[model samples]
Target chain A: MWTWFYQLASPKWFYQFSNKLLPWFRAATFILFAAGLALGLLFSPLDYQQGNTVRILYIHVPAAFLSMFVYVLMALSGGIGFIWRIKMAHIVSVSCAPIGAIFTLLALITGAIWGKPTWGTYWVWDARLTSFLILLFLYLGFMALHNAFDDRKTADRAAAILALVGLVNIPIIHFSVEWWNSLHQGATISKFEKPSMDADMLKALLTMIVAFQVYFVTVLLQRVKAEILLREKLSGWVKKLVTNQ
Target chain B: MYFQSFKEFIEMGGHGFYVWLCYGVVLSGLVSYFIYSKQLAKRNQRNLIKFYKRMDARSQLNANNQLNANNEAQ
Candidate 1:
């Protein structure tokens, strides 16, 4: 099991696998996203109070979920790289940063938009919102710190350490509603128990989650490929690959 | 399905602009990434070719210098 895991840590293996997976992710993302959006926008029942504005939840919730999830993934991968000195884990962590940051921004913007009509304000310093904002800052901090180093290895290690240190925020972001007086609603779509939503709404939300997952995979593969090409520029295989292209 | 025309779909019950704005941002991010990756590959390829060309020129120069030294020694 450990050997298999180590094999996957090989950059060549990752590069080859990512090449095979990219197109599949792209195709699945298209199909799933179309289905998800259609179901969410067209089929789901309108909220009794929020009306069609509730539709934004499909995108908002998924982005919010992914932002936190991706951070945890980054932190974990970074930790593994730190412990084992696996460069691929470092690459994975670095690749995750900008993508996670983008999702964080999406969540913040969409959440604020959702709040304006629902909470009668566009901004709030509520716990859930504030923690998530902190998360965005953490992502930005990691990226900035990673780039500031003149040496790439130093950058990777420094950024990995930042990611590991920032891991505490993930839980705080998740449970902020439970911990404090937050206007933001608690988990609506992610709860494991029977969802509070009606069937159509639940389906729409779940569909959106799947769509977002596909989108993440698609983007991650593309980023990983770019990282590999950049890092392996002088390798014989890369030379052949480039010349053939 | 809710809206009758394309305009009404854009309207999205007064939330159209906000919703569309989110989609627009996501699209732009993806597009920018695609463009960035392509440009990066092109730059790397160009740099690699430049490096090989310089290396080849240096080797050729050394070879000519070595031949001239040999002739001088003779």
Candidate 2:
């Protein structure tokens, strides 16, 4: 098991392993997204209160979930890299930044759109919304800090530290709805109890969440491969791989 | 199935604008990221190949120069 973990930490091994996994992830993402969309937009009944405007939930919920999920993933990868000095962990952390940022942006935009009809407003500075915005800025800050340093190792360390520090905001974002009397609604799916959603609606949301997660993996693999090639440009394996390509 | 016809579905019971816009933006963002990452990988490969080719050519030139200098000494 330790050997497997070390092998995964190796850039060359990761590159090869990811190459095999990417196609499957791509296929699953496509299938899940298609089914989720069909069910979410057409098959599932509209919310009795919000009507068709609730359709935005399909996209909004997944994007919001992924925004926080990716941040936590980034923070964990960054922590591993910091403690273990694993170059692959740093690469994975960096690869997740842009993807997380995009998801955060999507969540914000979709949330705003959904809010207009429901809350009669497009923007709100409530706890949930505000913390989520801060999360986005943290992602952007990580990317910017990573790029600012001329030395790769220094940049990685700096960005990893930032990610770890930003981990505090993740919990805040997750519990903001419960902790504060904000306009943002409470959780529909609780860990301790049954979800407060219809079966089909829950199915569609769950499927979309899976689709987004798979899509993140697929893209992360591609991004990590590119990062490896760039960072290991002079390495024998990279040279041979590039030549063969 | 929720809507009566294609028109109703498109209209999304009068909330079509928000619904479609949200989906459209998210889809576009995802697709663009996918395309961008693929292109970046291709570019990285090309850059690596080009760097190696240049290094190989320079080494070959140095070897040729050394051979000429050896011939001169002989």
Candidate 3:
């Protein structure tokens, strides 16, 4: 098991492994997204209260979930890299930032759009919304700090530290609705015992979540492969691969 | 099939603007990111190949210069 872990830590090993895994992720992402969108937008029953506006939930919920999910992933990867001194872990941590940032932006934009019809306003300073905005800023900060340093190792260490420090905001974002009198709705799908959502609605939301997760993996693999090639440009394997190309 | 007709589906019962806008932006973002990352990878690969070819050519030139000096000495 430890040998497997160490092998996975190797950039060359991961590069090859991800190459094999990416195509499957790509296929799954496409299928899930198509199915989810069709089910949510057309097949799922309309909400009694929100009507068609609730269709925005299909996109909003998944993007919001991924925003926080990717943050946790980034923080964990950063922690592993910092503790274990694994170069691949550092590469993964950095690669996750841009993608996470994009999700966070999507979440915020869709949330605001969903808000306009539901809350009669596009902007709010509610706890859930505010903390989510901060989450976006945290991602931006990590990316900015990563690029600030002249040395790669120094930049990686600094950005990893920022990610770890920002981990507190994830819990805040998750529990904000419960902790405060926020306009945003509380947990619906996350309640494993008895979710509040209808069956088809729940299915569509879950499918979209899976689709986003797979999309994240697919893109992260591509980004990490590029990072490896650039960082290991002079290494024997990369050199040979480039020469062959 | 929730909507009775194509028009109703497109209209989304008068909330079409919001629903379509949200999905449209999200999809565009995802697709663009995928395309951008793939382009970045392809460009990096091209650059790496070019770099190695240049390095190899320079090394070959040095080897040729060394061989000529050796011939002069002989």
Candidate 4:
């Protein structure tokens, strides 16, 4: 395990490994998105009360889930890098910010559009919404702090500290719907029992969720590869990637 | 497959606008990022080549200058 960890931590190994893995990830991303979208848009049944607006969940739910999932991954990587002084981990943590921010924006905008149709309003100060907005701000703040320092090591440490501090918000975002009386519905996909929705709807949502997860991995690997190249540009092996291919 | 026609599918039981808008915005965002990230990776590689070439050129110039200095001293 330590051998694997060290191998993964090596920027050169990660760049080559990701280069090999990307073709497979890209193929899976394409197939999964196609399947998920087909299942979501055409086969999934509508919510009797909300009508077609519920179909928005096919995108909204996955984007929202990715937004939070990416945040945790980012902060955790940042923390790992901070603790161990792992440069690759710092690269990963930094790569996650923009992608996570984009997903958060997607979630917020789609949620607002869905809200307008279902709840008759676009914006609300409810707990879930507010906490999630803070999440977006946190991502933006991480990037801002990271870029503020001219030295990469100083920037990584400072940004990692901010990310670790912001970990408090993740649980708050998860439980905000329940902790406060809010318009947003409590999450239904508990582990022990079948979800409260129709099987077809559940299937569509699950498929879309997996698709988005795979997509996140695909993009994350790409971004991390770019970052590795940028950081390792002066190193001998990175120059081979340029001169050879 | 659920709806009777393309037009009906597009209408999506009168909530079509929200559903399609969400998908469109989200899809476009994902697609643009996909393209942008790939381009960035390629651009980084290009930058690496440019960086090495500039370094190589500077070294060659330095070597030439050293040779001139030696010739002048001799």
Candidate 5:
């Protein structure tokens, strides 16, 4: 197990493997994203009241879900890197921050847009939105902490600790709707019951969610590859690779 | 198939501004990332070539100087 983990941490190995996997993710993202957009816009029936504005949910819901999901992933990656001192884990955890932050912002923006039409207001102190805003702040804090230290290792460790500590907000963000009588609507989709949504709407949302997942993997891989190259630039393999290229 | 025209698509049922803004932002973000990653790859490659060239040139200069010394000794 340890040996396998070390192999994954190896920059040369990761670079080689990711090179092969990038194309698959690229194709997956393109196809799935297109399908989601088509289904959401053309195939799905309009809402009785909200009309076309409800289409925003296709983007908003998935992005919000991914925002939290990516944070958890980042925190877990950080925890692994901190425990095992794996360089690749640190690279992944750190690279995920900006991407996760952007998605968090998107979720908030789209939510506000959805809110304006549905709730007749753009801003609210609702629990779900408030917690997500905090999640965004957490991402910013992690990015700032990572860049503050001169030493790369210290920066990684400090950011890792912050990420791990911030993982507590994930659940709070999820359950906020239930925990408080909030302005935000209850989930349309949940595990405990069948989704309370049109089948086409559910299909579109799921497609978009999968697209978001693929997009995250694709971007995270790109960022991690750049970090790996920079950190391993001094190695003999890097020298040969650079010269050969 | 959804909206009647590109014009109506832009209108987006009078919520066009918000809808288009969100779409524009998402599109721009994706485009920027693609451009940034491509530029990064190109820059890295260029720098690596320059570094290798400098190393090779320095090694050649040292070898030629060593040869000159050997000739003088001879």
Candidate 6:
């Protein structure tokens, strides 16, 4: 078990494993995105009140979901790396920052676009929106911290600590709607009891969410694989693979 | 399917601009990010290959110079 764990931690092992998985991930991401897009745009019923503006939820919700999800992963891995000094874990933290930032940006942009149609305005400094914007800043801060240090280990450690500290804001973002009188709607699928939505709409939303998650994993692997190679460039195995390929 | 035809679907009940704009931006952003990550990996690989080639050439040159030095001493 320990040997297996070590192997899992090994960058070389991860690189080879991801190489095998990349083709499959790419195919699945494409297929799922296509299905999600079709279902979201064509099949899902229009909202009675918001009409076509409801379609924005399909994109906005998934981006919002991924924004939070990626941050959790980033912070958790960063915490793990900071605590244990696992170099590969640091790589995971490093790779997750930019991806999380982009997801946050997507969520903010789509939410603003969605807002313009429903709320009659494009921007508001509401609590949920404000906290979410903070999430984006946190991601930027993490990346910026990572870049500031000339030393790899120090940079990773500093960024990891910042991520852990920012984990406090996650709950604030999640509950901001309830805590403050905000324009943002409460979650459609809250706490796994049942989605307070039509089955068809829920289906489309779930498909898109899963598709986005799969897409995230695919891209994350792409980045991690690249990071592993760059870090392992001096290793014999990487050299052999590089020259042979 | 929800709409009667392609035009209605595209129009999206007068909210077409927002819906289409959001979708277009998000999809294009996602695609561009994927492409960017792929390129980053490829660039690093190219750099590694170049690094190895440079190292190999320098070592070969050193070996050749050593052989000449040894022969001249002999």
For this target, which candidate reaches the highest DockQ against the unseen true structure?
4
Cα TM-score of candidate 5: 0.88
Residues A25-52 of candidate 1: C-alpha lDDT, one tens digit per residue: 8888878888988898788887888877
- Which residue pairs collide, candidate 4? none
Task: Using TM-score, give the best candidate's number.
Answer: 4
List of clashing residue pairs for candidate 2 = none
lDDT of 6 at A46: 85
Whole-model Cα lDDT of every candidate shown, in order: 0.83, 0.92, 0.91, 0.92, 0.85, 0.90
After TM-score superposition, the amount by which residue A210's alpha carbon in candidate 4 deviates from its true location, in angstroms, is 0.6
lDDT of 3 by residue, A148-225 (tens): 999999999999999999999998988999999999988886556688889999988888898899999999999998
Judged by TM-score relative to the true structure, which candidate is superior, 4 or 6?
A: 4
User: Which of the two candidates, 1 or 6, achieves a greater DockQ against the reference?
Assistant: 6
lDDT of 2 by residue, A87-144 (tens): 9999999999999999999999999999998999999899999999999999999999
Sort by DockQ, best first: 4, 2, 6, 3, 1, 5
What is the clash count for each candidate, in the order shown? 0, 0, 0, 0, 0, 0
lDDT of 5 by residue, B11-56 (tens): 7688877766776676577657755664564577667778778888
Q: Against the hidden reference, what TM-scores do the models get?
A: 0.88, 0.95, 0.94, 0.96, 0.88, 0.93
| Candidate 6 lDDT for residue B1 | 72
Residue A238 local lDDT, model 6: 84
Give the winner by lDDT: 2 or 3: 2
Superposed by TM-score, candidate 1 places the C-alpha of residue B2 at a distance from the truth, in angstroms, of 4.6
Candidate 6, residues A1-245: lDDT per residue as tens digits? 58867886789887887888888888999999999999989889989899989888888999999999999999898888888888789998899989989999999999999999899998899999999999999999999999999999999999999999999999999999999999988888987687888777888899999999988988999899889888888899988887887
**Which CAPRI tier for candidate 1?**
acceptable
Which portions of model 4 miss their true places by more than 4 Å?
B64-74
List candidate 6 segments past 4 Å from native. Answer: A1-4, B56-74
Candidate 3: residue A6 lDDT (0-100): 80
Clash pairs, candidate 3, are none
Q: Which stretches of candidate 1 lie over 4 Å from their true place?
A: A1-4, B1-8, B30-43, B51-74
